[model samples]
Target chain A: MTDAIPEFKKTEATKVGITGSALTAGIGSATRKEIAIILAVAVLVIGGLEFVLWAYDVPQYILPRPSLIAAALVKEFPLLLPHLGYSMVSLLSGFTIGAVTGMVMAAIVTQYPLVEKVVTPYILVLVTTPMLALVPLLILRFGFGYTPRIIAVALAVGPMVMINAATGFRRTDSAKLALARSYGASTLQIFWKIRAPMALPMILVGLMIGSIFGLLTTVGAEMVGGGFGLGNRLTTYSSMINMPEFFAVILLLSIIGILIYVIFFLIGKKWASWET
Target chain B: MVVKLAVRNAGKRYDDLEALKGCSFDVADKTIVSIVGPSGCGKTTLLWSMSGLHSLTSGQVDLDGERITAPRPEIGLVFQEANLLPWRNLMDNILFPFEVKHQTPDMAWITHLMDRVGLTGFEKRMPRELSGGMQQRGAIVRALSLRPQVLLMDEPFGALDAFTREEMNRLVEEIWLETKTTIVFITHSIEEAIFLSDRVIVLTKRPGRVHADYPVNLPRPRSLETMAGREVFDLMNKIKADIYGMSSMRPRSAAE
Candidate 1:
């Protein structure tokens, strides 16, 4: 009887273990199938582009061959690195300043009706006026160094961030606001805890858009004024008729923009997925 | 217990339209008070004024012996809708008041409250992931987590199905029994008011004033059985008659 009891218990345990393993395997297989489909799609798209490039004798000047761009990238690493660093510094600094100031302004505008009314028209004007047009004025005022580029980037990006953040802050549910008030939440606490978290996904979107604009403005300003950065190199290359180097800088800028977008996208997925 | 809330000649107006006029009532401590009326009877406005969420156009609201100027931590409010913060998970939503007030939530109390509400093991889930009943359960947990001395609920569980609403009514009765928190719950359902309240306050249409205040002498630890009894049915009919009779006297638009 003792031996039978032990044997039966062992059999039950093994059955349960096998069932658990099967369930895990089923989930894993499903996930793997999805990933495989995505990877196959990506490879096919990239391969099709390569075939087109090979079939049509597309000139290097119009669009450098991917392999040729790769070669240029490998060859120009040292030269690109410092310029990349400079652009990154300018982008990060300007983006940080613009985002913080925009948030503060949005908070003020949201809290005070008079401030919102006063700022709305100005924001609308800024939105309508192109940032590129103001770059020359910034350069004239701040000179041809990093200052003009940073200021230009900040000016170009601030309104978008401010508008998006303010909308997010203002769009909180009245019911939740009433609930918060009923719990005796102070204005600052309501802003920080309820309004801020609720606004995060929208704010991140603003940040992403702002960063892209900041980078673009930095490069645009650099191009407009003579500088020692990648934008300046692009201007020099174009003036000297150096197509390969010009294409290389363009590739670098595209990669930077994509990187900024991907980073913020991942953050939105990880932190704000609850929004769905 | 002494009177915890007193409303004396309290009135609220929105420009030309008066919502409540000369509304007066007193609620004893450690008791549940239900305010019942038709849709536009200003029951919600009265609760909002009591919790200091809305300003009184005339007269005053007193909590204990002191006058209420603004929302105090001592008063907790629950709306008809769950209104759980979507970005926050269940536990975080419950803990929101603490985070907002810069006070550390009592974890033991939160856990106990969650257990009572049957929300255990669902703490990490977002409000959207839960069913309507579950979301309302989370909202209740959130309100109770603050341990407020006075609880003001406006049509809480009004969105629930009949069965779920009945279940929640019992759950609320149990919580009130244990906590002894002074509760003023607003509902248009006469049966709900009778089942859950120590006293039921009825109001008339726009420029609402108390039409009747009936003390429900139902026994403690009320259950589904309490709802089925003769006294409960009698009280429910009386409240219905009071509401329908008063509402019928007014013009169509004004009645609504």
Candidate 2:
């Protein structure tokens, strides 16, 4: 048994080294292959759709060809660019306000029983009631400008953020809390050090979901009311029987949504790397 | 040496269950005391009371003649589970107590403690990446970073394998000898209690009270070889008999 000890240690060390090297190489190759596959699939699917549209001779007025949408986008480049910038500003401002307000409200509600009891029912109602139905009422109250649209987006996004953040904060481990207490940590110290870091990944989850909801609400409100945004352009072009321009605006909105999701996803992965 | 801790008639009750009744003990400065009892005998409850993590229904705990109403930095606690923050690496975890108290930890002492605990090369790894024994070592280091006058450990190695548990016990004894910190370690193993302690306090079953207080006469700087002697086995059998409430069934060889 004594003679076996050093041999055992040597074998174990070798095993660990081999496994570590294999894991690093495996992850590197897997990510590269995944990216290549995604790019190839996107090209094939988009190219197939374009080919089918060409073969069928689909009318550009009804469902604009991809080429026609691209041309329309270039033709209205100057006008689309400024309006796009304006819509983005509204979306970002509304999203930020809604996310921050929701997170603070969640922290308060979870920390205080009285606050939770008072606000829980109201939150449930807000989540269930469609913000789209409230846009017209808000427009009548706040007028046909940016105020109604921004408020609509905030109202639509707030509940998701509140619910998700509250759940995350509540899921902190009791043992960690006890450890902090034993170390003579005060209430605020425990919250900021243990609870906050533990809840971060979930909080980011809430922000991503809320941002998407905010963008959708912004588009919906702009579509229903007067505006110079992409959604408004879609409505105006469709009403004027300009299908290519309408399709072009819709495509732009989809791209914006994708970009927002990608940005939040990268942030979450970077900051919350400790979370499983 | 001064008396660092005194528990006077420390009793605790939970709604309908009596956890501890009339339990009292005194720990002198720079000594190691171990509390041993069967499961559910309030060994943990007593430790928590000493740490001021739980309030007693009756009686008082005094630390260096001052009444303890809440947990303070002067007393450190290590739980059965490692309970290290998963987000923190080993060094940050060791520095947690200092961070919470808004004091800068002594880097030289921390490095020395890490070396003493056989964790010299694991300063940058996350808790999840560590083995159970390594995590417990980190927990011990974290507890000691504050330079606490008294350390309360509740089965800190109960979850580790026997080999690792023995290694940890030796390491703890070495640390205690070097630092001279008063320690109250709770465990269920009689051999463990006798091996590492200056005195062992045994508690009776539910609604626990002190059953026996045996001052271990073993030599200082104890090693694994100390546990192999006949005297150690004799004491282990004696404590075992007492714990099992089988005083009549004491081993024939142990009678001498």
Candidate 3:
């Protein structure tokens, strides 16, 4: 008699009946389909552009075809390698210094309100005025070398990182902090264990934004004064009317920017998965 | 019986507003005491003051005769929500108290507590992956991990469904028996207060004060059947009458 009612079976049926179809739509397969669509659209667009340029008989110096740009990339790869090396070195070193210092400053300022009040106005000034505008002045003092470019890159990245990181550090849930205090957790312990981990997602966002800004400033500063770098190469190629090689350097910079974005995206996905 | 905890003339004023006014109570060792009050009656404020999370504007809370001005290691608090660290797994969240204290946790005891709370299989699960009831269960276990002499729970089961809340109430009774920890449980439900406590403290609204302290003489190890008995019903009604009587006397009809 009890079994005839089928109470448990009824609940089981209702549970699957509502969400079964939607849940079965696999995320992996959906993502793969999306990637395939994107690849097909890219092929069509680039291939169409190549056909139009070829049909019109555009001169290589005036507007290189997609094929010529590809060829220039392969042919000039050996010559462009040293400049790529120089740009990456300054970019990475400056970014490392900027990001680390920004995080440290954010932690300190947030912990000490008096210090925050004193330092915030200067940070705002750095944020509003383009650090690239200071590149010529930096070059005047430090000469046309890696030193000026690195300084400009670091200055450009620092304020961006500091602002985001500071906001993240302050965004910790008050309830969690109260819980920590109830356990008699010391200030340092609370900062490191509770506050820092909670701030990581925001900190990652800052690093992503800072890295892009750092790359831009590195290129711009190199264009202003430096004799060696991809930015310097861009200036040289354009001055000599070497259009294919100029476009090739621009292509390399685009690839580097995309790589930075993808690295941070993967890091956020792996480390901050619990946020969702 | 010895006084394990005491709240002496506790009062709190938020500038012009008085939250709690001269509210006082005492809990004997190894006993369950529940406090029930009307809305805005400062039940939570009293609980927070007792936990030493904050101080009363006047008066003090003492545990084992030592005045508590700030949070101490001897008392453990279960918040209104599970309040689990989202980034941490259940096991890591439970071990947080030990991390704060710089003390090594006993894995065997932790596993045992998890078993007792029916969270034995969920140690590695993240907080977001667990159900609300499961998260609350994990919180109860975390509070018990430190082996505190007194456990102060602020509406720990308030967020759960009726069935899960009852299950948590049962778990609380069972844990109290095994560990013999003095507990101060606060709630809005009169039946819940009488069902689980040896003594139920009732507080009035606004400038909250202890209106009555009623003792329950129900037999040990109470079940759902025990709660449905005539004696339990009478006790619940008596407390309800006291609360309703106070409501009628209010000059303004402030709905709860």
Candidate 4:
């Protein structure tokens, strides 16, 4: 029994050593491998489509080849640039307004449970409403201008940000709180020093979700109302039977979505690197 | 010697369940006192009460003749878990309590504390990056960072493996000797209590009171070899009997 003690302890120490050594900056080779896989799949799909379309002499109206889409993208760049600018303005401004309000609401709710009780039902009701269905109402209330488009984006994005931020604020470790109290730390000190940094992962999660939701709503709102966004360009090109240009607009929107995710990914790596 | 902390008939009740009926003890200044009991014996209740983290239902706990109403800056606590904030690195974690009190840290003292605990070069490492033993070591130093007059440790090494647990005992003993802080050590291990403390105070089951107070007459600066001595064995037997032998035999009296 006594002889087994040394072996038992050695194994335990080794377990700790392994866990301790594994604090990699989460954006390690795993992330690199994932990005590689995504690029490889994109190349294989696009290259295969281009090859099939070239060999079979498929119609441009049916499904344009990768080369045709690339050409259309280059040719229509001048017209698409203005629409892209409009969509970006609505997306960025609405996301900023919504995400900031969500975080602020999260902080206020965390400090006062009574405020949370009053606000939560309205948030839940708004969260369940679809972004597409709200455009008609938004247009009716605010007219066919930037206000309606921006409000649509904010409505779609706000709930996700608020939920994640609240979760992050509330999930602080009780042991850390006790330790702080034992040292006679004030409530404000504990909130800023211990709780805020610990909640960074959740707050950043809110931002990522809000960004995607903003992109979707901005495009959907523009498509519904038909004025000046990538979505509006989709309507115009399709009406004119410009399939290649329409596809190019879709590709641009997809790239913008990917770029949004990439920005959040980099921010998470830099700030909440301690998580993994 | 002056009495540093006195727990006078402290009682705690949670709704109907009485965790402690009446517990009384006095710890001398600069001495190590260990409270030992069986599981569910309200050992933690008494410890929390003494540390001013929890209020007693009956009596009061005094620190240097002053009543402890709430957590004071002069008292430090070490929980079973290291409880180091995972987001913070080693240096920031240790500096936390000092920063909370708005006091500038003594760089030499902090560096020395880290060096002695074998965590000198690992200051920049996050809590998760350190081994369990190293994390606990960091927690110990964090608790002691503000130079509290009394240190209350609630089974600080309970989660550690046997080998590391002994090493922690050595580290704590060395620190206590160097800085003669009044320490209230709570644990369930008989050997651990006798090994580290100057006096071992044993408690009964729920509604816990002072069942026995045995002064360990062991030699100073004791080591692993001290466990085998006749005096240590005799004391351990008495404590074991007081805990297991009597409590189990009179089970009905315990719940009352």
Return the top candidate by DockQ: 4
Better of 3 and 4 by DockQ: 4
Which runs of model 3 end up more than 4 angstroms from their true locations?
Answer: A1-31, A58-63, B244-256
Ranking by lDDT: 3, 4, 2, 1
How displaced is residue B182 in candidate 2, in Å?
1.2
On lDDT, who's better, 3 or 4?
3
A134 Cα displacement, candidate 3 (Å): 1.0
**Candidate 1 wrongly placed segments (more than 4 Å):** A1-31, A239-244, B99-104, B229-231, B248-256
Fnat measured on candidate 3: 0.63
Supply candidate 3's per-residue lDDT for B129: 68
The residue-by-residue lDDT of candidate 3 on B1-256, one tens digit each, is: 8999999999999999999999888999999999998888899999999999989999888899889989988899998889999879899999999888889998899999988887876788777667778888899889989898999999988888887777778888888889999999999888778878999999998789999999988887889889999989988988888788778565446674
Better of 1 and 3 by lDDT: 3
Q: Assign candidate 3 its CAPRI class.
A: acceptable
Q: Which docking class does model 1 fall in?
A: acceptable
Q: iRMSD (Å) of candidate 2?
A: 5.7
Q: Could you give candidate 2's per-residue lDDT for residues A118-156 as a string of tens digits?
A: 988999898778788898999899988888888888887
Model 4: how far is B183 from its true place, Å? 1.0
Candidate 1 lDDT, tens digit per residue, A1-276? 001111124344333333342111222223678999989998888677667777898776666566666677778868988988887777788888888988888878888888898889998787567676777887788887778777767776788799888887788788888878777777877787778987887787778778888888888877888567788888987888767677788889999987887687667656665564
Question: In DockQ, how does model 3 score against the reference complex?
Answer: 0.44
Q: What's each prediction's clash count?
A: 0, 0, 0, 0
Global lDDT of model 2? 0.82
Per-candidate DockQ vs. reference: 0.31, 0.39, 0.44, 0.45
lDDT of each: 0.80, 0.82, 0.86, 0.84
- Report the TM-score of the second chain of model 2 against its true counterpart: 0.94
